[model samples]
Target: MKWASDSITAGQITLLRVLFGFLPVLGYALARRALSRHHARHLHHYFAMSLLATSVFYYAFAAGTALLPSGIAGALSGAIPLFTFVCALAFLRSEPVTLLRFLGVLIGFGGVLLIARPWETTHGVDPTGVLFMLLGAASVGASFVYARKFISPLGIAPAALTTYQIGLALLTLMVVTDLDGMTTLADDTRALVGVVIGLGILGTGVAYILYYFIVETLGAVTASSATYIPPVVALAIGWLLVGEPLQLRDGIAVLLILSGVAVLRVTPRSGAAVSPTPRWGPR
Candidate 1:
């Protein structure tokens, strides 16, 4: 993945961008096919547009990384759950925001500050890149809320949803990318293939499927808490795969974030109406 970070040429970066951008769409389709027999739904049209917006933000981040520090990028991303909570409140009023949830958001935000230590940045991160990433998070949060309010009610299979999302994303990528430039694939075929396949299928495809399932069961606001899980996974991967030094601060931050998520999860329902349990597939 860091190879993506290390990409030198514009072509390489674009390739990575398109591949990663198209990932979730592919994930959606694969997930849908695996989960149910129903045809894809009209809701997929909105999901596709959302996926495109997500791709723009993701690609912009990847392209602009040189303008921003890695620590800052990671730090800014931690705000996703907070954004999710805010979006839930403003848009999806069904999600109950209680005192405990507010406290949890504060604690999680504090953890992000501890982790990023943004004050230490010498060159400073790109403001625009940061904004784009935050916007991306907000968009995803909105998508989650929409899925809960609109998509889940129709009882469409998650697998079908997954398929439509990924397939549309893939089509979008195919249209945007110049096929002639794909010759770069021959230079570092193995690495390129690895990135495309891993990010495309697993990171984007499978991840969203699991995400949709979680959303279906947990409700969007609650399921959004899973945003807390990735940083820990990234930290572990960095330590194990790249031998990056694991600092004590990382451990402490992880604890605080997890604790906040737990607080949000276990607190009593705040008289918020719950969505009906999805029946999984077609009616």
Candidate 2:
């Protein structure tokens, strides 16, 4: 996605992401006959999920990645798990909070401080970019909790949920996204392939199906732990592919953040066993 940022607008890329992503999901739903309409009561929940997880998250992350080094952007996104934990504690009545979990949250924020390096404002991170990344992270973080709380309990099939979320996102983007420079994406083969295959088909399409399955199986907080692995990958890609310089502090920060995830994972109270299994929703 970072590679494509220069050629395509963030909104256009996001629009294409869901546009392509929704195809397979819609196909799966049709094959399984899971295309039943959602209840009026749950309609709002689906909208909220789509807005948070798809619309806001895709655009914000794209914008942030465009402005900042992919490494820094990915590091900032490491906060997703922390924000998920916090949101779960607040919204999920069954979410247990152990001392180790609390400590993990602290450790994760410590890493965020290191990544931010607010004291080095002269050449420090861009505040706007950081804000965009955090907003994206928090939005998806909250979406995890929201799905677990409102959507999962209703037991919507993962394929159906994914279809609805991506489908709504695609429609929303179509309405608001400016198509002015969209054609330019085809001009750069690498960017075109990255946007279509990398971001669209795999990242948004297959990824969300797996994500929603995890959300249903393991609960929200645990499902969000999947995010912990991306920082290292992002840092490595930024250095090797983009030639972005990395410092010792960057490594340490990523270490602390992953360490936090490890701690949270080991905390018994934070285990997936604590998450209730999905129940079948109403017909």
Candidate 3:
């Protein structure tokens, strides 16, 4: 997204992401005959999930990644597990909210503040970009809980669930996205390849298939813990590939955020449940 943002509108990037990502997933669904087995009555759930997960998530990500340094943007996204735990506590009755998890949330936000540096008026992370990334993280976080609460109960296969979500997201993007100037991306080889191969196929398509499978097996909050890995990876990529400078705060922030996620994953020994792992399909 950072690579392509300079060449096209965030809306266009988001639209293409869903469009391209949907193709391979759609093909897999056809091969497995997953779509034919989908429950029509649950279409609304799929739409809602797609709206939050893909549409809002990708748009906010594109917009934020355009302004912020890639490392900071990714670190901010590491907060997804925090938001997921909070949402689960509020909405998921079966979700266990232990003191350890609460502490983890606090520790995670501490890292976020280090990244945002709202105290510094100048040279701080862009407030607008931080807000957008946070919105994206929150949307994805909520989607995790929502999926656990609603989608997992349907017993849909992971591939079919991903197909429904991505398919609807593609349709939604088609309605709202403008095609004008989108073709300008053809001139930038790096951006084009990054968007098509990196973001679309690998990031969105393949990632979500594995994600929903994890969600089905491990539960929402646990599945969301996967987000913590991206911050360090992004920081490394930003420095090595994009030549973005890394700061001391970035390393510290990544450490804190990852530690928080680690804490959240450790189940309490006080007999409290960790997270509700729902079996939607055969494991």
Candidate 4:
């Protein structure tokens, strides 16, 4: 979101790139061995591939955001829970589509609309950016579904899966990023440091670890529900750190999204049983 608002210095962008590039690898490595010992090899492979795909898509999404509107980017992100729910219903037998789940989806989307305040924003927001972010959200939802079906069943360690995923992403970025773009890093130490510290450790490393653990324990549908938290987090961060004023709509959106998620949480778990094999896995 911040990246969409203003031009991030080369150092800052690099820091974010590096952190996002490598943190998941550390998390995955921490848990990989344990997971390998417990789950089937194919399952591990699925987890690795899913994580890699997600990481790649995230970079694409972020880079795309640099060209799009922040409001659109945020609105697209808010669709994650709905997409996850749809993916779960279509691909994962363990997650069923109940009325309450549908209601949660409605509430969540409504919250996103409120948070985005698209109506209030001027008409200059790029439609392309909104599509790109939505695509990213869809990719993430698919990843979550796969993780729940394949990774969770295998019970591979979340840290290990995260490590491999991040490592793969880092490798991909190293191969694809323009070397010339990196020269800016030497000119701005503070920005570079901030990017590395904030994005790498906090956003990519720690956040992914928490995400994987949540996915492993709660299943994909429940785990993906956490998507609602980030908007609130971002809003609070902006208000406290940058002196941005909070709006009434933001509060209403939070209430709606949280209420929707709460409704989903209180709903009974699906009675359907899922097979452990990859072929039977969620998408």
Candidate 5:
């Protein structure tokens, strides 16, 4: 997506996302996997989840990053898990929303505030971009509930689930995408095209497999907590790689976010069992 985002128009990049992102899953979807009539009919649900989780999320994320600093954007993007927890409370009957988890989410959001400091800067961050980031976070957050409520119960393996999701996303993207812009890739240097391949296969495709499994194993809110990592990484990259200023607030924000995640891992007062059972066992 990073590579395609450079040369391809936003509309084109959205289309190429399906192309690059689906490459890793091309064979996996075709591999033998039993599909019930219900699973077949409900495929649209998975596609819809993917649409928001990946496609829409990508759109908002791209727009946000284009407008905001990397650290600020990453910090804001970490809200996905918080949104996931809220969605879980409202939607999933199984998501146990203990005081600790709720408080932790609050703490995390507080840290996000320190990291973002939206009040401190109105110069660089556009309201539209901030709205896009929030939308991306919300879409990703909702995706977790959608997966837990709709997809997990279907007794589908994560790999197979990801396979079908990506394959279907590809088909959906094709219908709306302009084919003419795809030829622009021919003019791109080999390195740029290779980056596109890497981003598609390694970043989007493989990551979805791990992400879906995590959602299956840990529940959406727990799995979504992994969102905390990117902000710290983005801060580091911005400082070391890009020479962006690393403020004291950034360090403090990182510590607070980590603490918030630790708070979530604390044992519940009831000490309820949290081990997850995947609906479909490995083939």
Candidate 6:
């Protein structure tokens, strides 16, 4: 959304994040009769997770995209699974450890290494941008782990959780947002509105709905492994449409991410025990 970055600051984008990303979701949740005040009551249990997952996730991402090439940003997203794997292992102790799962985590991280290639300045990627990507990845990673632990145990419906999560995120964004940045949208209302709505509905709303699906069905680590795909797609878009050069390292990074995800997919075969237990009521 940096097309308007010249006019808008990241804080302003974050303020809009509430409207663009979560408001439609809240409306959707209410329309489906999926949310209520009672759900909000237990929301404190999920408050931090939702906050990290959505608000912090998008804020850092807005900064990252503003500063970095879309391809590099995509590659950085690959860090989510790795970060989640570590988070789950350390924080969400319910997930069992196995050789294959460990191997998958390592393999995925190896792919991230090839993509980041911090030693090279060939692409002119901004270091601050890379840091933003990592922070975003870490936020999502920790949130996923927390979801499987604290949120899933509540046995709340995924739709309701989506509503609450996005709702909480909206509230958090409001606290830090700058209303004056709205002046930037005066020039390009369509692109600005479109960016907000598209990202809000598709990226944050629909995306997280699907995300919880994987979190529930597979273990959290497996769910996090999905992170690897977006970077490859981003790289392709950058190369084909945006005219960003995809270096040979980028190509190898894609292959490694594919291989890493393949390894992660194999994890579920031996990882059934680690899957979040799906008993029918809250703990």
Q: In terms of TM-score, which candidate is strongest?
A: 3
| Clashes found in each candidate (C-alpha, N, C closer than 3 A) | 11, 0, 0, 11, 0, 2
Ordered by TM-score, highest first, the candidates read 3, 2, 6, 5, 4, 1
lDDT of each: 0.58, 0.83, 0.87, 0.59, 0.69, 0.73
Better of 2 and 5 by lDDT: 2
lDDT of 4 by residue, 172-269 (tens): 55565555555455466654554566666676777666766777656776677777666566556656765656667666766786666566655455
The TM-score values for the models, in the order shown, are: 0.71, 0.92, 0.95, 0.72, 0.82, 0.86
Across 62-152, the per-residue lDDT of candidate 6 in tens digits comes to 8887897787787778778777877887987566676876787677677766766778887587888878988998899898888888777
Candidate 1 residue lDDT tens string, 134-227: 6656667667766766666666666666556555555555667555554544466655765677655566656766766777777776777677
What is the C-alpha lDDT profile of model 3 across 1-283, one tens digit per residue? 8889989999999998888898989888889887754377898999999988999999999999999999889888898998888898899886777788789888988998899888888975799999999999999999999988898878787788889999999988899888999999999999999899889999899998887777877888888988868889998889888898899988898889888877887777853435455545443
63-99 per-residue lDDT for model 5 (tens digits): 6766666666666777787778778778977666678
Instruction: Point out where model 1 deviates above 4 Å.
Output: 8-49, 52-57, 60-78, 123-133, 176-182, 243-247, 268-283
Q: Evaluated with lDDT, which candidate comes out highest?
A: 3
Candidate 2 accuracy as TM-score: 0.92
- In model 6, the runs with Cα more than 4 Å from the true position are 2-6, 121-123, 268-283
Comparison by lDDT, 1 against 6, better one: 6
| Candidate 2 vs candidate 4, TM-score winner | 2
Give the alpha carbon lDDT tens digit for every residue of 81-182 in model 2.
888888988988766678888998899889988888777877658878888998998999999989887877776778888888888888899999999988
Supply the global lDDT for candidate 6: 0.73
Q: Which of candidates 3 and 5 reaches a greater lDDT?
A: 3
